[model samples]
Target: MSLAEKLCLTAAFVFFMTGLLTGIWKYRCMARSENAVAPRYVDIAHRSSLMYSFAALLLGWFAGYSAYPDWLNSVAAASALGFFALAIGTYIVHGVLRDTGNQFRKPHRLGRSTLPAWVIHAFMIVLIVAEVGGSLVLGSGALIAIW
Candidate 1:
């Protein structure tokens, strides 16, 4: 496998392992809760980790099939994978802290200081662009390879 594929698949494996751990945590949290629901962020972390693991697998497949240079493919895959890690890490942090269930609510706060709404909006915008743009790059390369 190319470096890109290896990188993506490795990340996928890590995400899968994290998902398993988070799943156990979710179960424990649910057991402790009278309402039988885990902390919202814990559930989100578990689900997102699993989902992103599959996404990384897909990215690895595309990377393997891409016609682009291995370095370029690696960059593309890394871009998306980086964002996935960031999001998962954030979710895990919130899960551990049991922070606000909704991070986007009015007057957002990272910890003690209030976070500007635009900061979150900007991050969302950048994340969308990076994830979609990177996938498009790899997908286009794979399509080219097929054709």
Candidate 2:
């Protein structure tokens, strides 16, 4: 198979994985009411998992778009690097302040990145947000917006 095909498959896999993990994590979070082991942290980790899945989707898009630059995965390595940096920064800010970021001005509540797990979860939420947001913003939008 060509590099594009391989990347496409990889991207598809990532998308599927993201959806799958999100569903499972959602289940676990809900199940916590029934089971003691099911803590909110599972959801936190799943949030990041969802982000990975999104990043994969974007990379796949980039790959399927064209087979140029073997390293140019769908989101671009540079973009991924930036995403990670954002995740880390958000995690740190939330952890230190125990509150939502002032810049983004999100409400400061339970998911304020107080614990390590919360930071990771925030990272995932932020990551996927960036992924989907990037796709919408940077993408040509032909495939996404048929309207």
Candidate 3:
């Protein structure tokens, strides 16, 4: 596998580990009190981490098998890794803070923290564009190779 593929796989492993750690935290919290509802973000983090890990693995495999150039694969892998890391990190922060309910269901008012919010949105947009664009390039390359 190329270095990019390897790095993607490594990110997958890190995500899996993050999931396991979150799971442990959830279990401990539940064990401590019957009425304790595991933090919404904790559950989200655990589940999403596992899902993202699988996604990274699949993306890596696709990149490896496809006829795309190494640079394309590198971009895809890097984008996926960045998104996964930031997403999980956000979840972890929310979980740690035990913030007000689900941030998704009701948007939290970020009165003074516009910069962080803007940065996150920008990063997410760029990463998603890179990932999707890379995937398209790789898919086209594969199709061209087959014909």
Per-residue CA lDDT of model 3 for 8-105, tens digit only, reads: 78988999999999999887777776787687778888898998888778777766776777887787678767777878888887777776455543
| RMSD in angstroms between candidate 3 and the native structure over all alpha carbons | 3.0
User: How many residue pairs clash per model?
Assistant: 0, 1, 0
Tell me the alpha-carbon RMSD of every candidate.
1.0, 8.3, 3.0
Please give each candidate's TM-score: 0.96, 0.37, 0.79
Question: Cα lDDT of all candidates, in order?
Answer: 0.91, 0.49, 0.74
**Top-down lDDT ranking:** 1, 3, 2
Q: Ten consecutive residues with minimal summed lDDT in candidate 2?
A: 101-110
Put down candidate 1 lDDT per residue, 2-65, tens digits, no spaces: 9989989999999999999999999999999999999988999999999999999999999999
Colliding residue pairs in candidate 3: none
Model 1 pairs in collision: none
The TM-score measured for candidate 2 stands at 0.37
On residues 1-147, what C-alpha lDDT tens digit does candidate 2 reach at each position? 445335545644654565465567567557666663434334444465456556655555554544344443334433543574454344434433444433244333445333445665686787777655544433443243333
How do these models rank on TM-score, best leading?
A: 1, 3, 2
Supply the TM-score for candidate 3: 0.79
lDDT of 1 at 65: 94
